[model samples]
Target: MNLVSVQDLIEAGRQVSLTGSALAEQAKKGTPKQREYLYGLLVAGVEGLEGFRLFFRPFPRGSRA
Candidate 1:
């Protein structure tokens, strides 16, 4: 499997953080459509991070080779 670099993960985390912060600010005064957009970003960010986590985590010792 191809390994993801630490820098790449850091950049992804930064992007997600910025997007989440922006979403929070917009949510304070956003319209229904804007809220939906922000929600979508939030979900995408979360799922993306989870994917990265699973990708980087070491395999279990007892798992098949």
Candidate 2:
């Protein structure tokens, strides 16, 4: 598994926006229908983070990174 820093993710998002993400700006007149896919990903990420932060008990010190 690869670990990604928040800063890296932010930079990637900026690049995606600047480049006009395909799913978000491919149509001729308006936004693409799949634009909302980004929102779904954000929602899922938030929920998953919440679970990892709140639902699990802490591991013993020096367990896993």
Candidate 3:
């Protein structure tokens, strides 16, 4: 597996955050199509981040109970 470096992860986070912020701005303008696209991007970004976190961190504690 290709390991992601800290810098790579940071850059990805920054890009996703910026995209989400732009999407929010578009959403505030009430453009339905833009809003939909923005929502999709936001969801993908969130899922990508969650996957990254899961890959780097240990499983949640107390889950085995």
Q: By TM-score, who's the top model here?
A: 1
TM-score of every model versus the real structure:
0.51, 0.37, 0.47
> On a 0 to 1 TM-score scale, where does candidate 3 land against the true structure?
0.47
Clashing pairs in 1: none
Q: Give a tens-digit lDDT track for model 2, residues 1-65.
A: 23433333344445334343442343223333333444445456666767777878787898994
Q: State the lDDT of candidate 3 residue by residue for 1-65, as single tens digits.
A: 24333333334446666554543444466455544554556557978888998888876787752
lDDT of candidate 3 at residue 64, scale 0 to 100: 56
Instruction: Please report the candidate that would top lDDT against the real structure.
Output: 1
Query: What's the CA RMSD for each of the models?
Result: 12.5, 11.1, 13.2
Judged by lDDT against the true structure, how good is candidate 2? 0.46
lDDT of 1 by residue, 1-65 (tens): 23433333334445667544544554656665655555556558978888999888988899965
The per-model lDDT (C-alpha) reads 0.58, 0.46, 0.55
Ordered from best to worst lDDT, the candidate numbers read: 1, 3, 2
Poorest stretch of ten by lDDT in candidate 1: 1-10
lDDT of 2 at 65: 43
